[model samples]
Target: MKPSFRLLSTVAAAALVCCASSSVLAQSKFVLKLAHADSADLGTSRKAVMADTFAKEVKAKSGGRIDVQIFGAGALGGEREVVEGVKNGFIQAGLASGVMANFFPGAMVTDIPYLFPSDEVADKVMDGPFGQKLSADFNAATGMHNLCFGEVGFRHFSSGKKPIHSPKDLVGMKIRVQETPLYVTEMKALGAQPTPIAFPETYTALQTGVVDGQENPIPTLIFAKFYEVQKNVTLDGHNYGIDWFVLSDKFYKSLPPDLLKVVTDAGKVACAEERKVNRTFTANGNKTMADKGVTVYTPTAAELAEFRAAAQPPVIEFLKTKIDPKLIDSIQTAVKDADAKK
Candidate 1:
């Protein structure tokens, strides 16, 4: 039987649509949704740069076999939510911060005050054997693969009420701390009353005086615009922050050997790019703050010593009860090794 011309045309159109769908599917063999809480401004946000760079790297390396979509500025929710998503395989990847401690207590060791003497030492320790073990442990605990440790730089104290010169300056002030026991204990050891607060609510807490101050990396202070509400910044460099580039174990294992290598290698590249942008911002952040009318104070050597003496001991004691003492010793040993090599 001869079919009508209209019916033949309809069948041809349907066949074309099916072919197009198949082509699209073949081009993008894998899709990654990477999320973070940082601002969407790629020029100023290190997280954005890292995610964007990873997307490009993977696409180029795989020759269009993989697709990466980035969601910044809490697009998929805050850091915690993003971490949870990655763990459960709902989200493929995330740049997660201190919230990582909740799932892997061993990670809290990095939060020890004045842990790394300098950025060089920090890089050596975190990118060395110690980092490899930590990544493995984190993967075992959370079922998420740690691609690399991205820097959040060093955390410093900032206040609207006063300039902090030493531990005494923070005494009795209601400082906003992340909703973590280590942060609360660290602040208390420094003599400040630690008020546990969510990160998203921190700026408003500072402005409304719900909390007198907060601590974060300089780049965070600038991008989050905490400088607008807070009048003073103390470069105490209390803790060097480390954020993880995590991927869902399921998603990672599903990748072909070639694509898996591409993603892992691309992660290292993205990590380096993030650190470069972050350190540049950190080095010049004080000047930017000063121009914005914020008082930027760098403590004298003696004063910084006072901070180290006050915060490190108590935080160490607190951590001993939560994690193995041996892990803590390894970090200190690794730091010294890194310093000696330099």
Candidate 2:
């Protein structure tokens, strides 16, 4: 028997509703919450650009199958907390810096004083075999997948009280540093008292004289407005800072092969873009800081050598107690190999 017109219309309406629901489901196969403690809206922020690029690329390439939600400016929490969230599956991904050493001690190898002489060498070492091995080890140890290594550029000293031109300048100053042993050891060796302060608290610390100065990349000095509080910026380039694009292992496993490839590929693309942006900012950093009424001092080659001499030995000895000496040797070898390449 043929159905009546009204009955046929009702069946068609039901089919349309079912199709719409399925379409909605397909549009968002995964909802990824990526968080960081930086300005997402800031056009010049490398951290912000990194997160934004990853979100944009993943959404476009995934065809909306992956929904990326970015919470910047510590909307979620500090780097450590955000990384913890990623590890626990509360946050799908995050960009973590020095705090990563707390989770994976091996990461401290990257913090070795005077590690990379140039961006080219740093890129080669980090994107090559050394980085791959580190990534795999980080995943195995923390159960959080490191998508890629984005850069924070080379860290420099910024002081509100005085210009830091040599190790003597830092003597007795209370410098804010990440809550890690390497930084502490480095500061002590430099004859400064290292105060372990959270990133969010750093500005106030400097303003209130809780800390005399801090060390960070030039872009970070601008982004965090550290220049406002710190008048002196010493381009010591003490440490080659790195930011990890990390993902939850559980979330990673949930992705099918195609989607997984999309996320990982997007990570590489985003990391490269971040490095480009950061290097550009760093290249012009001296002038940028000077324009802001900050004293930008480029230490002489001899002065920088003094910094390396004072900081590296203690940090290396401390590292030997905490991690495999062979790993330390390997990273040094990797840096040498990378430098020799061109």
Candidate 3:
């Protein structure tokens, strides 16, 4: 009972159709949406702009099969909120730090005062074995995969009320700090009353005398126009900030191997470029604060050491309640290693 030629040809045609459908299914496209809480500008928002570069690179490299969409400036809420969204698979990716310490307490290690001697030392420590461990710890705690780290520069103190030449100058001053316990502890230890304020309201907070002073990288102070309201600036370099480029474990797992490589490579490129911009701003752009009528003050080595003695020990004691001191010790060791190399 052999089939006729027409029947055999019809069976072969159906099999071919099934194979074509399977091939199409295997090559399905993936779209991931990444978010950040910066106003949409490369000049002001280093991480936001670089995260966008990650988006563009993913699209171009995936040949349109993978799309990384970006939402900036609280479009999906602040950094901590977006971090929650990503962990739940409600969002794909983001660039965040600060309140992220709440989710992954180990993250606050990066904010420890007087940790890095200079930007070069900080960079070496962060890109070395020490940083790798922190990234792994962060991934374990929060389920977000770190791609690369971008710089947030060193935070300095500025005041609208008075010039801060020493820790004594900060006494009786009301200082605004990011909504983090460690920052609060740091200010209290330095003899200032710490006011926890949201990022968006800081300028007005300064102008209206709600807060006498605040601390942040010079670039951020310039970008946010803090110089307009705060006339006194001091280079304290108390804390080094890191922008973590991360993808949700859920979204990362969804990608096929090839597309993952594309995302990872793009992240590295964006990280490098953003750090470069940060360094350049620290060297040249910071002088603008003085030009804009904000009195810029550089602390002597002895004065800065007084600040370190006053602020760091108490903050470390405070952090011991939240984070592993062992981790902090390891980081200190790494910083020393970096300094030794220099």
Candidate 4:
């Protein structure tokens, strides 16, 4: 009563095909959420635009194996809250700013005023070995991954008072600063009464005279409508404000090898694209602010040097207490190397 060999072969082949189709149906897909502090519709918000780029790139690169859900305008929470969510696996990713120092004190390296000579240099270093090393250390310390540095462009001074020409002008002025000790120290060193204020509260703080001035990159100043409340904006480019895209160690490691590669690749592409957006907005942002009646000041070389000289030394000393000098030396070396190519 044995079956024919051809019949047996056909039955086995059908069973194998069924199993293969079932396996395909049962394969797991990943869903990741990215949180940031601005509205998705805010064209000038680099984080928002960057999240869009990352989401599209990751989805395309993963071939529907991954889905990125973006919660902007602090829908998930503030920068610190979002970072904490990433750290604890409550959220998968976030766009975090200097507040990252809360978890990795070494992040203070980014806070040094006048750090990166140019956006190009910052990109070269942050995407290179030094940034990778720092990012690795951050991952090891806090169970989170710093995917890459996205741009916040260069910070400039703006005031309801007069235009800022030198540190002396900042003296006695009450300035709104990110509620971080590093910034408090830098503004104090520059002679402003550094008033730590929440980012959401800043515009109202300015309007009410709770603070006379604030500092942020050009596009931010304009989009945040600081231009409406402030008359003079200085173009000192005092600091290159580097923002980070972070992922949870748990979520990142959970990805299969091929998917992990796709995510990492998407990170680099998205970061570069965000930098382009920041650069474009910043280049023409001065004119935008001027159109809003903001008096823009471009300092002479001597005037800028005065501001940088007065601002750097003490902050370098302050950073020494928080970060190793060797790491700082490493950053400067990377910058010099990046610049040497010019």
Off by over 4 Å in 2: 1-28, 160-162, 197-211
TM-scores for all predictions? 0.87, 0.85, 0.91, 0.91
Q: How far is each candidate from the true structure, as Cα RMSD in Å?
A: 6.0, 4.6, 2.4, 2.4
Model 1 misplaced stretches (Cα beyond 4 Å): 1-28, 208-210
Give the range of the ten consecutive residues with the poorest summed lDDT in model 4: 37-46
On residues 198-282, what C-alpha lDDT tens digit does candidate 4 reach at each position? 8879999999999999999988886788888999999888888778889998898788899888888888888888899888889
Error of 3 at 16 (Å): 4.4
Encode model 2's per-residue lDDT on 244-321: one tens digit a residue: 999999899989898999999999999999999888887776677878898788888899899989999999999999
Q: What is the alpha-carbon RMSD of candidate 3 to the true structure?
A: 2.4
Candidate 2, position 18, lDDT: 100
- Lowest lDDT 10-mer window, candidate 2? 38-47
Overall local distance difference test of candidate 4? 0.86
Model 1: per-residue Cα lDDT over 1-342, one tens digit each? 356888999999999999999997775589999999988888788899999999999999999888899999999998899999999999999998878887889999998998887889999999999999889888887788999988989999999998999999999999987778888889999999999887778888888999899999998788789999999999888999997999999899888899999999999999989999899998778778988999888899899889999999999999999999999999999999999999
Ranking by lDDT: 1, 2, 4, 3
For each candidate, what is the lDDT?
0.91, 0.90, 0.86, 0.86
Clash counts for the predictions, in order: 0, 0, 0, 0
Off by over 4 Å in 3: 1-26, 281-284
Q: State in Å the error of residue 291, model 2.
A: 2.2
